[model samples]
Target: MIDGLSFSLLTPPLIAFTVTLILTGWLIKNNVLKVLDHPNPRSLHTRAVRRTGGLGMMLGVAISWASIPAALPISVSLGVALLVLVSFADDIFGLPVLGRLLMHGAVAIWFSVALLSEARGWMVATIITISVVWMINLYNFMDGSDGLAGGMTLIGFTCYGLTALLAGNESFAVINFCIAAAAAAFLIFNFYPARIFMGDAGAIPLGFLAASLGMIGWTKGLWPPWLPVLVFSPFIADASVTLAKRCLSGEKFWQAHRAHYYQRMVRSGLGHRNTALLGYILMVSAGVSAMWAAHEDIAVQLGVGIVWGGIYLSMMIVSERYLERCPGD
Candidate 1:
């Protein structure tokens, strides 16, 4: 048998990955629970498929996080739990937009006040609070395509976890790593021609954690605030650009549509597997550059960002032209 301390260090990620596998298997096998996501104008999937994979992913994280007090504080876990419940309801009953956003905002407020109690200024606290809400929503928005969200979660958290470890923040590292592990396990079922979808339940809570843990890392001086931005730049760039376009065009941003860049690419004839792999390439590039920049001076960090920014710009333009030539709608 393994020694206690050593075993404990390995427990969170191991248990999360294993449980995710088991839950995914069960979810796929139990046809009664299959929340077949019917096809729509915005949907990439043509047929109904299970949408309960979020339960698998969230269950793994929830069970493992509760047991690892050293890695994830109870307050953070509570915030995740609240979002998961609200999102789960949204998945089942088609929650009203305003109500869902309000609950998300409430959770953001709780996080900002409880965690940043000694925040220097109310303005700072308010801004962080709003950012948290955006993080939660944007992630849910970006979960439209097969493999996109799971790949981002796996790559982004793995990068964050590794960087935190390098900075001597083992607690942050372990939590991040375990999340990444769970995401990886979930990806097996969520990949191209996905057997299941993550739904709002998984996307929302994961988004909140992405922001919350990034902030925690920053506060602890474990990593720079922009580090998370870099690690998740692909999703951030895609979601931010898509939101801006919708605002400029005066569209109802909350309404589901296939306007997102990743969605466009898939609808534009680039298959799901190809678009997902391209996303993976971008993710790895951003993550590797972020890790490298962590060791360099401020100027080098900016240069790294600029390089990635240019790449993102190129992708956006390419996607646009491709869609213009072969419009999906």
Candidate 2:
């Protein structure tokens, strides 16, 4: 009785949203995991809060995936599972940074080489593998602020779902929509004055999915490879630039710090709520533009990239000037 992209197709995301909302609320109320993120020199928040929101969000995603008939590639599914297990371990018992990086590299290589090498060749796959590893770490780097990662996940995955739908890939759309929906629910508790954090367990897997799913969509002709880059340009830009700056200054890039543009914005009196709002604006604009340019010719897509590149450059300059003028107000 329903029309195209009807109830059946939409049910999975709704289930995902509901499950995450209920589960996240329960975890917060009961202090289920007792994983507390306390304030630290590098932290943005001043008080301790639960960091088990990732557990609820991922459980929601897993349950929703179980109900859907569409199956992700076995390599991707296994890679995500491994990340969740290891990241959750890192969350509870402090794992060595070297060990975590090795695991991330192994998973990235597994996903990229095992699945992508035949289609894109080993050289291209190697580059993608490195990008996947960067995405994993960059996501964790950007998860310091309230609502930042959650908002990015919701907007970024929704863009992926929309592009897949436009490409007539209903199953793929459902998968992405499920991710966005779960992120949306997670945002309820993660917004300014956060009740919980997604921790490494959530950020790591979400980052992997962002890169791997985007690659899958590209290989399947759902969208161009660059579209994913454009959709997530906000995160990629900030993290990449910050890392480069640190490395050039002879600072250890791997150590946690509050030097990200967003972190500085918050510390410079922008506050978490406004900083997150600005981030959401950037994310939504990038996502919408990527979706619009998905089916256009090469020139239009290139224009989109150039325009965003300029915007990011200008924003970074403005942030730098502001920091110099304010000087830790």
Candidate 3:
């Protein structure tokens, strides 16, 4: 038996994993929500798959978060609930993109204002609010491939939890660990030939939490703001760069396309499994470095960011060159 195992740490993740596994299995068996994701021009998957995995994953996270109420703020919890409801509606009824973005912006602004209060100016709040919205949409943008989003969630939150634990913030650590564990459970069916997709219901709220929790931790002094950005940079870099490229080419940047670096890798013969595995390697490396640098001085943290920026740049250049040589339809 493992000695010194605290129930506080063990119980929440256990609940998260068990709930996600069982619910996901049930969703697969029943197709209860019946939100089928079909192949599209931008889709990576070839056939229709049930996208109800988000219901199971978010349900598990909600249950676990409820169990550890002290770890999260009431406002953030409410924001997540709002995102889930609106996002699930979008999945079912296909809500207008503008309307959905409005809702996203509203919640982000509210959260940012509450988070900053009188401590910061409107300019700072505006930037963070925009960032929160970007994170929400960017995560949705990056969820096209198998195992990519789930793997990022697992690694990113684990890094966040570990950083909080190192800083002696047990409640915050448990909150993040539960999310990571739930994502791990989601990955059981999401890897490679995926059985289900998280859909908007799952991805939007998770993106919100990723930004919200990271900002919360920064405000609370548990970790630097750069740490969260670094940990989630895999998704960030790919989505932002792709968006930029599309805009530069005078393309409809908001419309879906296989322009993302990872999507290109998949189309360029990397396949889903290898692309996901390689992505896992990048995610783990980024998260580990972020965690380590969180405890270092300002100079070291800045250096870490610069180094990772260079690495991401190199990877993108290599991927673009490889794709130019093998341009897949």
Candidate 3: segments with Cα more than 4 A from true spot: 1-5, 69-71, 325-329
Q: For candidate 3, give the lDDT of residue 79.
A: 93
| Over 4 Å off, model 1 | 1-8, 32-34, 326-329
Please give the lDDT score at residue 15 for candidate 1. 86
- Listed in order, each prediction's TM-score against the native is 0.94, 0.97, 0.96
Off by over 4 Å in 2: 1-4, 325-329
Per-residue lDDT of candidate 3, residues 1-329 (tens digit): 64444777888888999999999989888845778998987688899998888888888988987777484666688999999999999989999989999999999988988988632788878888999999999999999899999999999999999999999998899999999999999999999899999999999999999999999998889988788899999999999988888888788887777778888888888899999999999999999998888878999999999999999999988888888854422
**What value does the lDDT take at residue 141 in candidate 3?**
92
Candidate 1 residue-wise lDDT, 119-164, digit = tens: 5667877988988988888998889888999999999889888898
What is the clash count for each candidate, in the order shown? 0, 0, 0
lDDT of 1: 0.84
How much lDDT does candidate 3 score? 0.89
